[model samples]
Target: MTRTVSDVIAALDAAYPRELAEPWDAVGLVCGDPAEPVERVLVCVDPVTATVDEAVETGAGLIVAHHPLLLRGVHGVGTDTTKGSLVHRMIRSGIALFCAHTNADSADPGVSDALASALGLKVLAPLAPHQVGGTTGIGRIGELAAAEPFGDFVRRVAAALPSTVPGVYGAGDPHRPIRTVAVSGGSGDSYLDAACAAGVDAYVTADLRHHPAGEQLEAGGPALVGVTHWASEWPWCGQAAEVVRAAGNVEVHVSTRCTDPWSLRA
Candidate 1:
């Protein structure tokens, strides 16, 4: 069955409702006409140049991204600027761009859910429960079937996530036993308190800043597992592709190109 851009969007909204997005977040279609026919969709963590090129090369009619290309307000989108160049490229290539953002994070089978499941954790509940349609929330708290040392768990995390230049790192005692785990897929420092309150053995997340992480550890919180932002969020792309595929008869491709800004770490 042929599906238009709006049809695919409706399917996405059903899974990750835009209403669930934080007020500050920008979610939904960034470009393309509602009536435009869509047969191929590309999913990725970021809609950067590499992913855009992937869409063009693969002849994808639409891009469903976890991060919005234009999160904040923009003055212009003329071909000169970085974001503007992306806009022009998509327009010229007849590819639409849509973002899921916080909405996907808050979905029941959301970003954190994917992360937790990837690490073989059985989900218990949302770390910060949202009183919405379903049991959707920002982060997740789960339990490992068997407890393992912090160091072993860190290796497991590194193994689970897509390998990047700066692999996963951990804080707290390497010998500490960890069973219960709390995870947030992207920039999860804000959820440290939630993870601690849940009394999990470890908190796994991405883009953890030095001060917040150090302070959280000083306060005797859970062991911290810090991963690259892209790795933390990449698992959701496959899950999201499933959602899109269920919506219509379109070919969905999850871009494998790593768009993490940090190339090499000293």
Candidate 2:
């Protein structure tokens, strides 16, 4: 059965409300005509150059992403600028782009919850609880059934995430048992203070810059597990795809391409 872009948009908007996005944030349809018939959907953490190519190769009519393609306003749509280039590519190929971003991160079964499950961690509470009409915020704090040493937990995280060389940013003692864990998916430095506030044994996330990691460590913060931004959030694409598929069986493919935007050296 054929589905329109509007169908997918409706399903996503229902799941992750556009209204829930931060005032400065952009969420929902960024490209493509809602009237266009969507036979195939591609999901990814970031709608980067390679992921876009993957979408094209997979014959996707729509690309659902976790990050907004046009977060800040652009002065021009020329191919010279990165955002413009991507916009041009999508328009040229007739591929639609949609971003869930902070809205998805703040949803009930959102980024943190999905990552927690992938690492076999059971959620105790939200690290930063998601507020729905003065409800709460949605970053998760959780625990493994049996407490594992920080080293072992790091290995588990490295295994769970997709990466060439995943870096472990161990903050506390390596021998420390990590029972209560806090996790936020993308660039989560701001939440380090929150994790410390919660007194979590460890906090796992991506794109941990050197200074912040060092500062947090010296400050005796949670043990850190820093992963590639792509690997840290790739699991979210599947979660989103499931949400879309469950709405109705529209051909959904989680793009297998690595869109990390970096090549790590050993």
Candidate 3:
């Protein structure tokens, strides 16, 4: 069976509506013709050169990336430049590129939902609800079935995420009891205040910076578990692949390559 790029995109957009995307986001298709027939698709967190290599090697007809490849404007996509080479490569290979990005983050069973589920949290609600809708927002508020020590919760978080160089690090008393928690999948410092507002026992997220982590802790916010950005969002690749594969006429696969840019932790 075969389906057009448009068919696959319709399934994705229906699952993660473009209307739910932030105003500044560049979600949806990045390249490829809608009318082009597609037999296989690859899903990944980043739309970089390495994932592109995986797509080509695996003979993928389309790539459903969680992040946008062209988030910012570019002068041109000449083969000489880095990003341009990727665009050219995809074009020549008859492959299509599409991104879910913030829309996927804000969807009902979105990025944060996947993150929360991986750590065995029972989802309660969105950490920050969307302005115009219910059950759709930036992050999620959830709770474990039973309270555990913050240290144990931290270990659970680390084990749940894909093993990475940075791994997972926690702040706050190891003995502190953790019941409710909040989560956001990628670069989630922006939601630190929101997580606090939700009054979760802890917050699990990626890319926590020095000052923000300190301020949040100093202000008596939730226990913090900082994970690598790539590891945090990596679970969404499998979730997305499942959604696309169920749409039929498409063989979906999640890229196993870790495109997390951080190489050395020490």
Tens-digit per-residue lDDT, 93-136, candidate 1: 99999999999999888999999989999999998989634479
Q: What order do candidates take by lDDT, descending?
A: 1, 3, 2
Candidate 3 wrongly placed segments (more than 4 Å): none
Residue-by-residue lDDT tens digits, candidate 3, 32-97: 999999999999999899999999999999999999988888889999988899999999999999
lDDT leader:
1
For 185-256, candidate 2 gives per-residue lDDT tens digits of 888878878988889888888767788778877888788887777787888888999988976859999988
User: By TM-score, how accurate is candidate 3?
Assistant: 0.97
Model 1 clash pairs? none
**Backbone clashes under 3 angstroms, per model:** 0, 9, 0
C-alpha lDDT of all candidate models, in order: 0.93, 0.84, 0.91
lDDT of 1 at 139: 90
**C-alpha TM-scores of all predictions:** 0.97, 0.92, 0.97
How many clashing residue pairs, candidate 1? 0
